[model samples]
Every structure is written in structure tokens, then in C-alpha cells.
Target: MRLKFQFGSFITFIGFILSSLIVTLDLEAQTHQFKLIDEETNRPIPDANFFYGNEQGISSESGDITINFQPTITLTISHLQYGKRSFTAEELDQALKKHQLALQPKSHNLQPVTFISIHPNAGEQEQMTLQVQDKLAHDAGQVLEQFSSISSIRKSGAYGFDPVLRGFKYDQINLVIDGSQCATAACPNRMDPASSQVPLNMIVEAEVMKGPYSLRYGNAFGGTINFKSADPSFTDKANLNGRMGTSFETNGEISRSEALLGITSKHADIKLFGSLSTGNDYTDGDGVKIPANFYRSNIGGKIGLKLNSTQTMSLQVSNNYGKDVDFPALPMDLRKDDTWLINLGHKAVFYRGALSSWSTTMYATKVDHLMDNADKELNPRMVDANTSAKTNNAGGRTELRFDFDDDWLYAGTDMRIENADGTRKRNMLMGPMAGKTLTDNVWQDARIRKNGLFAEYHSQGDNFHLVFSGRLELNHAEAQNPDAGFAANYTDMSSDIVSPALSIGGTRTVTDNFSIGLWLGSAQRSGSLAERYINYFPIGLDPYEMIGNPELKPETNNQADLIFNYKSDATDLNLNLFSSFLNNHISSEIRKDLSPKMATAPGVRQFVNVDKAKIMGFEASWKQIINRKIQQVAELAYTHGQNTTSDEALPEIPPMEFRYRLIGSFINKKLRTELNFRHAFEQNRIAKSYGETKTPAFNVLDIKASYLIVQNLNVAASLQNIFDEAYYEHLSRSVRNAESRPIYSPGRSFYFSLSYRF
Candidate 1:
């Protein structure tokens, strides 16, 4: 609740006249460090790890490190004794003018592409880099709604949202891309999620794996996300590159653009990309508006090959589209959506031994959805509903990784095939069913086929590091046509599930800088496709008309976690605590012998099997550098869900949140600035029989800057919410006649961007 200071001084004077119309005149360059050498004993090597897009930094034992240039600053170094590479910045700016830079010590240590196990192996790994240099993120749930612990599910006005970890969400989390889990959400109130169909400038990284540790990648009960994009490399001559960017904002005049291209040779590689975005309807620091409109687009391509030198292969394709999207708290309005994706992959490595690497991936997805209420507003028993949906998925995975002496083993096999069918139509257009016409079949051909087998084992020492994981699955669901009110209220819709999963975690060093970690897990999830063939369909959440419970029964998450850490040189910290204990907990119940077909529905609900439930959480993170021109980051999160056999509470839980950021690096780092703040605190443990609503606290502020208009171009600006905060975010959504109104955010905006790379 902060606004009107002349609307934050007219959005800080329109972000200072759009940063003086795209600023100019300021060219400084000071920040240093870019040294790492050891090409055959050239010395200085220590700790290594570098990256640009996903922004990582390390290298200090004398090997320097510090990067923030851009011109497509591609980095990606990594080194244990030299084992990864990718350079650019004009091949390291002449070794940063002799500031070192040299590496090449891989007689054959092969294995890259994270065939599996590389991230905390499964116990608490969080890597997010979806553009967050102080505000301006369009999708991927606005970059996990700003990291730490995470929560999102704002049912659109800005784009699908979704993502909710800790308390889990939809299919209990598992969003893969690049190892493709083929985009899955074709509206059923999910308005097309799959992290909003990629395209956040084609994401270059996103990783999270918090609870159910890992089981290769299947039945993840509540954690797993891996989104990576853009992988191109080559040398030995022959190259061509490209990139382009665009952005603009001022409360709903949103627009974005993207482009990229690549070509390499020495074996082969190719890439292409495209993007587009648009928005409108925004004005809410008490100035109303808020219908939230959208249009999106994306295109893609990829190719690679290098058949010798330890095998490799790749292929990719993509398509994403959306139009006129909007969901005023859900009731149809998304007029179109189309998604298509494909993936293929292969790799082999030998390093030396009985088995070292093997990987394979294949995928496919398709979605076509349409929704309508003819854009809301109009009613008097005047029917006009419409909905058309589609979803299809295909999957694959193959793995084998092994090494001994220090330990590592992994094996896998995966499969999936899903299909959901839909249709709905109505058209009364006037009184007493005037000129009636109705139809149904909201998913009458549901199907699910799965098969899995996984394994993992790892070990390390010098302090500790361990892992072990497992998975076993065989699910088969079928509705295969059943829509006559779902075969007269249920006749055993056929299911055959067998799930199992396990995980173990480790990390311990309790000294030389503190460290400790632990994890335990169990997972299972079944019952989807609308909990087993939705038929009455109102998609639950109070207006109630849902039904679908083909003998439901599979929901388990017996998790645990604990962690603590601390680092040096600038600062880095962590603290986590988590819990999950649920069993056969799939909610919804109430079917007073069914009787409520939409006249503003009020009875009828199905999909049961609720025995016990629980969820608990905590998170804290910090990063600091307070010296060379300030820097800091902070985070805190919370969760608490429950349903202890109906003692209630738990339906879109999300309340405690905190964030902070502050950065500045002027005249030497080529100018950079940031300040971010966020808070959320009021939310009365909702779920009042699921019409949940109690939000009230919020605070936001943002400011940004960027320069660098040379070394390949850059420009940025921001003012987002600088005191204009009408807020509402506690798992948003309300207003069916306004139940304490929610879903409001976006005011005092001004953002700008420009990018280029060679």
C-alpha cells in the first residue's frame, strides 16, 4: 500500500525520461581479474569455474576471476585440472592483456553435458539465472518469482506462472527442458505452463532439486527442474555468430524481442532462434485497469554432430505461441495457445575404463488450447462457454555412467506417453436456453503410460559428499472414452500404478568454514489427467462441479532435509530445513449425491483419498561482497501446509517471503546499479474449504541501471514499483464477485533494454 506521490512522481519521471532516451556518454572500465593459467605448467590455476549467461564466478587461489562484460560474453570454463572450455570475449581479450588465461589439460577426461550427477548430486542445488539484474523478467514464473525457496501460480494476466516448490504443485514438480519433459499443461486452469513454454530469451539455465533428491527423472513428488538452452561451440576455424535483443515497458506497453543465430564447424553445430512478446492492460497501484492481455511467440532450431572423438549428436525444434491471454481469476479467456517441441540427443564418452558415459534423450510435445467466455462480461443465464484443449507428450531417456576409485554410478531407462482429450461447447445466447446447443467431452480420452527404472550412487571425501537414489515405476491410466457424466458416475476407470522412489543425501565438513547437509526421501504421485478423467468439470476450487476419482490412490512424499553452510572471501551462506510427510493425500471431497450443473455451482466434488498430509519449510540464503563497489543479496522463504485428515489448511499455500538485493558498480564495471526489495507477510493460513483468500501484506521496490553500450552493446533501465504497490500475491486469484479481491500488481512501471552480441 504505497502509491500516489503523484504516482511515484510519475514513475520517477518516466524513469528519468527513459534514461535520457537511451543514455550515452560514460565509458569506464576498471574492475579486474581474468587470470587462470596452466597450459602445461604455466602455473596459477586454483579453483576455476566461470560462466557468463548463468553467471557463476570462482577462480581465486591466485587465479583471479571477475566478469561482467557482455557482447555475448560466453564463458563456461570449469576446471579441476582443466576439463571444460568455451571462450569468447574475443577469445579472452588477448588473455585479458596478459592477465593470464590458458588451460588445456585434458588428455581424455571426457564427460560433460551432465549425463547426471554434477550438481550437489541431488541434495540442495539451486541455480537460477533467468535475468534478474534488478527486475524485468517475463516468465519462468518471473524467474522463480525471484529465487529462494520459490512459489508462483498466479494464474495468468502476465503468463502462466505455476511453479511452487516446497509445498509442491501440479504433477508435484518436474520441469525438464533440453532433456525435454515435453511441455505439459494445456489449460485446465494451468493456462499453458512448462515454464510458460521456454522463451525467456531462450533461458540459459535454471536448476533446482530440493527434496525428493533425484530418481533420474520420474515421479518426482516435489522437486526437479532443469532448464538449459543454447549450447553451441566450435573452433579450428569456421564460425559465424549472432544475437539481438529488445525490450520496452511502461505499464503495459510491454514489448520484447529476441534473435540469435550460430554456425560452427570442425565437426558441426548450428542454431537459430526467435521470440516476440506483447502485453497491455496494467495499472494497479490503485489506479485500477488490470485485465492483463498478452501475445507471445517463439521459434527454434538446433543441430550438432561430431561422430568421432567420443560420439555426439543432437537435434531440436521448437514452437510456442499464445494470443489474447488473460485470466481474471480463471473463467476462460485464453483464446489460443499452440506449442510444439521436439528434442533428440546422444553422447558417449570413454575417458578410460569399463564404462564412463552414455546418454540419450528424446522428446516430443504438442498442445493446442482455446478458451472463451467471449471475453467475460455478459450473463443472465446467457450461455456462451467454449473450451477446446489438447495435450500430448512423448518421452525418453537412456543412461549409464560409472567410474570407480572415487565412486559414481548411475543407470537409467525412462518412458512416458500421455494424452488428454478435451472439448466443451455451449451456446444459449439468451433466455430459456434460447436456440440451445450444448456439448461435452472435457477429456474423455485420457491416457497415461509410463515406465521407469533408475539408480544412482556417488561418494566423495576430504570431508564428505554422498548420494544414492532410486526409482521404479510402471503406471498406466486409461479413461479411453468415458463421458456420459463419466460413465454414469464412475465405473472403475482403469488404473495400474506401481511407484517407488528413494533418495539419500550428504555433505558434511563442519569446520573450516562450516558445512552440513542431509536429506532423506520417498516419492510417489499418481492420479492426474484431472485426477482420473475429469467429467463434471468446473476444475475445482469452490464453484465446485468437479468429479473424477477412478479409485484414486497414490500420493506420497516422505521427505526431509537440513542444511547449513558458510563460505569466505566475500560471503555466502545458507540455512535450510524442510519436511514433507504425506500419504494418499489427493484432496477434494463432497458429492452430496451430485446435483449442481453450473448455475453458479455450489455442490458436487469428487477425487478423494485424503489420509494425512503435511509440509513444512524454511530457507535462508545470502551472498555479499560489500567491498569493491557494494553487492549483496538475501532471501528467506516459508511454507506450512497441512490437511491432517481434514483438520484443514492447504490449498495454494504461500505467504512468508522476503528478498533483498543491492548492487552497484559504477564507472569501471561500466556502470551497473540495482536495488530490489520485496516482502510478503499477511496470509492467514488459508484453504477455507478451498475458496482460500487472506492476503494483505506486501512491499516492493525496484530500481535498476546498466550501461556498457560498446563491447557489443547493452543498455537497461528500470523503476518497477518504486513505491507504487497495490500488491496481492499469496498465491493470487480472487474476484468472482470479489472475495476480498486479489490479483493486482503492476503499477509505476518503466523498463527498457537493448542488447547485441557478436
Candidate 2:
């Protein structure tokens, strides 16, 4: 009986071992699949080198190369200039099965040989410029304050982001966030739909296209700023991530807490980002308390799917709410402002041969806003004034690129439809005394439709390169208002513009450490709605009001720019110079003594088409890797603008500025610190309508430090306005009161953040 039991135990042990081996073999047989792509354009990459253990693989010629391997094999993907990327066997298997892997292209060698490469977000290619990541800010209003070009940032009582870009306010420049355009209607007070609704922390990056090179964005006469958010990452594996932070200021106001939560998996990725911030009224540098206390709350979510190797679909929804936000410069304060956003998009790429590579995207957006005046009793002019506004936009874009041997060519088409509607009502106390006890209610409705087509060709060789490109656009606009008390009937304003763009540039390597490049280019832009049909009250100008012209024609501009770049292993420098000439330039001018009813006033401002204008500027930037532990960077920008029609300085031109930065890293890459300083030459040549006084120049300082507390944890702290400067920025608006109260920026402030990943 003992012998029989022993035999049975031995047989059972052998069977169990065999079963375990079979399961291991089956798991190893499961293959992992993945696709690599360009981060900027979402295009697949080809001819990339991939390695696993001792095995090597290369991408296919069509940029759609695939790799298959066991779940336990460690993998690495790399290219000459791009940094190397490594993934564990399990991670690769998960990503391949789910299809959510993307790689950033190497930038050092990616510069086009024959074409003046322009990124979709970065307007026209003028010179090398630094792009800022939006995640550095806690809110939209705070994000704009980080840029040098922006002088003042404010939140309307209605909870919108109102920014003064290079001294130009309200409608002078075009703002685009995730392919959506914002519209202003109601009250002419611009109380709602402020840039603040889009939280800065949600933005991935912001590209500022300086000058008129951004004609494609809209009728932007000044420039275009495109705020892009981070794309969702989808991988075969399931992962979760979250972030939390807090901030404080010296003005006795404690900010509320904020946090973010997100998750990604092979089948789908979902992200929920939100923040709740509240603070009491802040005091200025001199201990003078400003009554503009504010609180804000925002939430954003995105759902993304990996449809297949060549396709992706995504849906995004976001909302922002603000309350009791005050503006010292405005006559009235904002009581409540709300913004809602919804976006859906699809991206795909098709390849047929050496000559067929194309990409397409379509999207739509809607914006709604409402605003009411606070302190109405103190400001009788706004006692009974309120405004409500809505804007809708839809657009589609397609591009086809072909490559042949050493030559390449591309063509693209884009179309967009935009509609804006709003209403403003005045209370009985604010009724016009001279006019019929004005129950003034103004309604404005307008439509803008545009279509554009463009093409470019390039040929590159070892010693030389050449490129040519052109674009033609057709625009149609119509505005109707039943209430004549505010706007006139500008039935239809249409034009077909063929704005040809050309660029020629070449590079020659003179030595092992130096190279020379020369470039020249030109572009054109049309007028925007604000310059066309704006007829509203002027808050900045004491006694004058602004009226739009219905008969205004399209403005045209011609520009040329040159750039020089030099680089070595440790140091790099870039210099640029550009000039632009505009014809039929649209500007607001005051007609002296034109209105008999207001004869005692200075004059009335009206939008008019000027005969000519010119702008010239230069930018220089240098970066030095100094040593293994330290790096330094410096930049300078100067712009000079003039109205040739009147032979005077332009009203809202940016001022000369200088920036310096130093970064230090210690304990390998574990601890880092940065110091930044900026100086601006005050803009003295202010437009009459802008203000009655000139702004003084000032200097500002900022500091940041970060430490990796552990493998997956990081802590950071930052200080802005380190010196507690009391001067107002040139971009700040002036109140209409006799005291001319200028909006003062926050004195000194501090913020701390913590992030963890698992």
C-alpha cells in the first residue's frame, strides 16, 4: 500500500510541472505590435531604428513600420538626432495591442532644406523662437502673465480671460484655442467669454505668431496666438496618473486647493482635470487694498480611442465658472461668468506610393457667455447694463504631400464657418437723457465664411535647396442688426484674395563648428470684424466713442524677413530682421468737432481705412550650455511701427524688451533651479484713445526650483514679481475716472506644486 501511494504522488507532480510549462509557452507566443509617429503633425515615421535585445528592426519606407515581439523582450527605439526611447517587454506588448504609442521627432536635423518650415501653431516662420508650455500656469489668466508680450491680465466680472497683448486690447488680435474662435457681443463692455475660461494648466503649449504672418487665422491685423492642449496618450497597457498643488500670495489672500486625475489603457483613455481656486481682495505694493477679489473653478475632460493603426477618434468637454471677479480699471465689476466647450475630431493618414501621403481633420466648437455689472449704484452709467453673447464655429482641413527621390511637394485646402450673436440691455437709470429715455437694446448677428487653398514644392540636394509656395483665399462676411440704435446694416462684405507666399532659403556648412543660412519671405492679411462693423462705446477715451465703417475694404500688407543661425556643441545663436509695408491699413481715428451734439468733447473715434503703414523689427537669442551643470540663455526683441498715412508712431506697437535666464542642475538630474529676469522700455507713444498718460518702463524678476523627491514624485516652487514692483504695465487699461486709476498687477507671490505617477 505504501509503494502504490508514492507512485501516484510522483505522477501527479510531473503532470503539474507539464501544465505550468504549457502556460508559459502560450504567453510567450502572444505578439506585441506598435506604430511610431511624429508628435507635432501626428504623422507616422519611417526608417527608424528599433532594437530588442540583440535583434534589430527598421521602419518601412511609408512611415508605417511595425514591430512584433514577445511580451517579455525589452525594446528601444531611436533615430540619429532624436533622443532614444526604451520600453519594457510588457509595456511594448500592451502598447502594440492597443495602438497608442507615439514618439517625438528629433528637432536638430528636422529643419527643412528647401522650405521655410512653419508649424501649424507657430504662425509664419520669421525666426527661431522659444515655445512656452501651458501646463506651467494654474489658470488661463495666470498663463498669459508669464509671457513678455502680455503686459496685463484680468478676469472680467463675467469670468472671461481679458489680456492686453503688446498693448493692444479687445479684438485687435485673434485668439484661437483648440481650433475654436471666441466672439464678443452684448453691452459692448466685453464682459464675457474672456480668455480665462481655458485653464493654463490644461494647455500643452502656446505658439505666438508675431506680425501679420497669421493671415490664415483670420483678419488679425496684429498677430495670432494658438493655444494647443496636450494630446491624449493611448497604450496597450492600463495606467493611471494624478496631480495636486496649492498656492499663496503675500497680500493676505489664501488660494484654494486644486487637483487633476487621469487614466489610460489599451482600449481607451479618459482624463478628468479640474481646479478650485479662491482668494480675497489683494493689496498693492504700497499696502493699498484693491477691491478686485476673485474666485474661479474649472473642469475639463477628454475621451480618446485608438480606432486602428491609421485612425483615431476623440471627444472633449470642458467648463469654467467664475464669480465676484473685479477689475479696477473697468467702470463695473463682473458678478458671474461661465464658459462651456465641446470638441470632436478624427485624424487619418493614407499612403499609396512614393507620391501619396495625406492627412485630414475636422472639428466644431460653441461658446456662450453672460455678464452683469457689480457696484452698479456707484457707477450709474452701468447701473442697468447687462450683456449676453454666443459664438459657433465649424471647420475642416486637408493636406496631401508627395515625395519623389530628392524632391517633394504638398497641397492643402481649408474651410471654416463662423457665426456670432449677442444682445445688450440698458436699465432705466442708465437711459440716454438726450435721446428718447433710451430703452437701449442692441442686437448684433454676423456670419463669416472662408475657404483657402495652397500648394508648395521643394527640391533638396547635398549642397543646395529651393522651395516655392502660393495660397488663394475667398472670404464672405455679413452683419445684420434689427436695433439701429447700435449697429448699421452691413449686408454683405465679400472679397477674393490671392495672397501669394514665397520663401527662398539655403544653407552652407563653412566649417565643422559653423554654418550659414539666408532666407527671404513675404505674406499678406485682411481686415477683421472689429475693424469693419464695430460701433460701440469707448471706455478708455473720456468723451469720444468709436464707430465702424461698413464700406471698409480689405487691407493688404507685404513683408520680408531674413534669419541667421549658428551652432556648436555648447553654444547656439539666432538673429532675425524683418520689415512690413501695409496699404489701405485700417485704423481708428478721431474727427474733431464732427458731432455738434458733443461739440464740448474732444472728438469721436471712428474706424477708417488708412493709405499706408510700416513696421520693422529685430530679434536676437543666444543659448550656451556653459558646462555639465549649468546653462544660460538671453534674448532681445525690438519692434518699431509707424503710420505712414499720418507719419506718426503706431498706437499699440510692442516695446523693446530683454530677457535673461540661468538654469542649474545638481545631483545628476535630480535637483534643478532656474532664474529669470526681464526688462521693458516703457511705451511712451500711446494712442490717444488708449490713454491720456504715458507708461513708465520697469524690470521684473522670477525664480523657480524643482526637486525629484523620489522615483515617481516631484515637488516644485516658484516666485513671481520677486521685487514687489509697484508700477503698472504698459498693457494695463486706465479707468475713466478723473483719478485715472490704473490696474495694478499682483505684488509678490509664491506657488508650490506636487505631481506623482505610477
Of the candidates shown, which would achieve the greatest TM-score relative to the real structure? 2
Q: After superposition, how far is residue 110 of candidate 2 from its true place, in Å?
A: 8.1
User: What local distance difference test score does each model get?
Assistant: 0.71, 0.55
Cα lDDT tens digits for candidate 1, 1-758: 22242134334433432332221222224433455866633445544546567445445433556554566577777652355689887877777666678796532111111111111100101111113231234467666655657678785558888888867887788878754465767677777877887655545556677677777877777887776654434445788876677788889888887776878886788878877778988888999888888988888888887665445677878788888888887767898998888877766544344455566676778889889878776546478888898887876777777656455677877777777788788877676778888888878868777778888886755556678888998888877778766677666778898988888887766665666778888988888788777777776556687877877889898988887777665776777878898998888888798886556667878889889889997888787889988879888888899898888788888888888999877676666788988888997888887778678888998888877656656687789998898887777676455443667878789988876666
Please list all clashing residue pairs in model 2, or write none if there are none.
33-96, 94-236, 95-236, 100-234, 157-334, 158-337, 160-194, 161-194, 161-195, 161-196
**Number of clashing pairs, model 2?**
10
Candidate 2 per-residue C-alpha lDDT over 1-758 given as tens digits, one digit per residue, 9 for 90 to 100: 63353234334433432332211111233334455656644444654556666445454322443444655777786653344679887777666665545676432332221111111121111111112113333355445655544543342211344565544446545667653434333324554434665655556456565444334344344455666665556655788865555555445464655556778887677888777766666655666566656767778888877665544566777776766666555545666666666665444433334533444444455556555554533533423555565665556555556655456666766666555566555454433543322332322455555666767665654433445555566766556543464343345443444444444444444444444545444554444444554445443334455555555666665655555666676777766666767788778777564451222235567677889987777777788998988999898877677888787777656578899999887775677788999888877765554444677788879898777677645677778788887766554555435665665666777766565433
lDDT of 1 at 725: 82
Report how far off residue 424 is in candidate 2 (Å): 2.3
Task: State which candidate has the highest lDDT.
Answer: 1
